[model samples]
Target: MRTALTEMLGVEHPLVGFNRSPAVVAAVTNAGGFGVLAASMYSPTELDAQLTWIEEQVGGRPYGVDLLVPEKFAVSDPDDLVASLRAQIPAEHFAFVDALLDEYGLPAHSAPRGEEDALDEIAAAINPAGAQALLDVTFSHRIAMVANALGPPPADLVSRAHADGVVVASLVGQRKHAVRQLEAGVDVLVAQGTEAGGHTGTVATTVLTPEVVEVADGRPVLAAGGIATGAQMAAALALGAAGVWCGSVWLSSEEDITPRPVKEKFLAAGSSDTLRSRTMTGKPARQLRSAWHDAWDRPDAPAPLPLPLQPMLAGRAWNRVHAAAAEGHPGATALDTYFIGQVVGGFTELRPAAEITREMVEDCTRRLRALGELADT
Candidate 1:
């Protein structure tokens, strides 16, 4: 229960749950683990509102915010970056998305929401300017930490967060990335493997964890990817992780905002039912295998566009697919998928977020003790 992560964050447990829903974040934090809210999906104003709401629910418990700050992206003038990115998306990509929707017999003729709304959607996730705005808003909050989801935190951002007495963390897929992040002055490193739900590298956790731990040079490293149970958490500790950074396990929690159709798919999925596909985000992220991936993976299908463009092209279609799936459309259901890790196979039922946190800690304690007995023998 007492690892560097727990001590550094001042939490009762070393389990850090990263989720998009404020409810789940608050629940995990209040249940004695550090909860991190993924803020890339929100605009500055929306993030402010969500963080304020989470603060009220958690009642002074420490929580963190995660932002997608990719090291490489298509460069453009900051003022017009969103518009520039939007313009770069090829017409063929849009046509491909439309064709897929049409083939499924879904409505392909929805009216445009508006140019401003479209620009906002594109900028919110991939633009550096948007991420900066979100960081400004996050610092205004009582956040305990800030994590860069894709790569090392920008140097200025790290300095700014440090000045405000907040710890900065970064997720790394490789040992070299871990060293780069530490050099960038990150306070913690999350060594995520390919089995992780969202953006990840091809390395397995079992290999990546120890490699990162060795290179970390006394800095704390959290093990991620394919970790869902207490035994796995114990294994991560045995592998030299300060703790575990878990995301996918929380998706099946009752407090999670995962769509019912997507949740059903996750619940039914086996360990192999997921795949790394660029169909969701331009980057290869692990998501439950579905017809959506099947379409994109076809040899004849056009290759996915880079970064922001790919998400921009498919974002609207995904919204429509989820809406139709909610309405009992089989085609939409077939296409519906969400980011989840390989540990999803163990998610047989929905439980409260608090209960899951407590059980994981208790189970991890028991498992570690059992291992100690084996060592004695």
Candidate 2:
């Protein structure tokens, strides 16, 4: 509990919870762990509203914001980036998605289709300009930190965050990436493993954590990926991590906003039930094995488009899938998958986020004490 992360983040426990729900974020922070809200899905205005609401809920407890500022993506003219990207999505990909829906026997979409709107929804998630806009909104608030969920935090973003008295953190899967982030002046490093949810590299946490810790040279390093229990947290500390960075564990928490059917799927999933596929975001991200991914993985299916386009195309389809699943469509239910880590198999119940944090910390404390007793003998 008294690691460098605890001191740096000013939290009683070094457990940092990252989630898309403001309720979950506030709950974790209020329960003595730092909370980081994922802001990549939100527009600047929407992010402002959510952060403001979180501040009201946590009542001065420290929380951070996470943005996806990938180091590289298909570039385009800022004035019409979405339009440019839309044009690049081949007809075969669109036809493939349509064919999948038809095969599922789902109801036709009743809502009007707006390609521009879909592109706009995901533009910030794939481009630096969109991330910059969100950062502009973030610096105006009383956030404790700003994390780049993907590549290194942009130099200007890091400098601005530092000037605003907020810590800058970046998630890296490779030791070399960790070195780059440290050299780029990142204040903290989240050494995430391939087993982590969402976009991740091909390194296991066991190996990646120590490698980053050694390269960190004493800077705070939080171990992430496949960590969902106190025993795992204790193991991370044993590996020299300042603490654990948890995301997927919170998805099964009571405060999470995951759809009911989707939550059921996550609870039933095993460690091997997930796959790293670009079907969701273009870049490889771990998601529950579902018919959606199965269709995309077929040898004949059109290869997924690159970043932004892949998400843009899939985002609309997912909206339909969720809507139909809510209305009792079996096929839609089969396609309802979300990003989750390998630890998802342990999520047997929907407990409160606060309770999850407290229990994990308490268990970790007990384990450490028992280890100390053994050392004394």
Number of the top lDDT candidate: 2
Q: Among all windows of ten consecutive residues in candidate 1, which has the lowest summed lDDT?
A: 115-124
Alpha-carbon RMSD, each predicted model: 1.5, 1.4
Off by over 4 Å in 1: 76-78, 115-125
Among residues 3 or more apart in sequence or in different chains, the pairs in candidate 2 whose N, CA or C atoms overlap within 3 Å are none
Q: lDDT at 286 for candidate 1?
A: 92
Q: Report the CA-based lDDT of candidate 1 relative to the real structure.
A: 0.88
* Model 2 spans with C-alpha error above 4 angstroms: 114-119
Name the lDDT of candidate 2.
Answer: 0.89
lDDT of 1 by residue, 128-236 (tens): 6668888889999999999997777778899998899999999999989998999999999999998999888999999999999999888889999988889999999
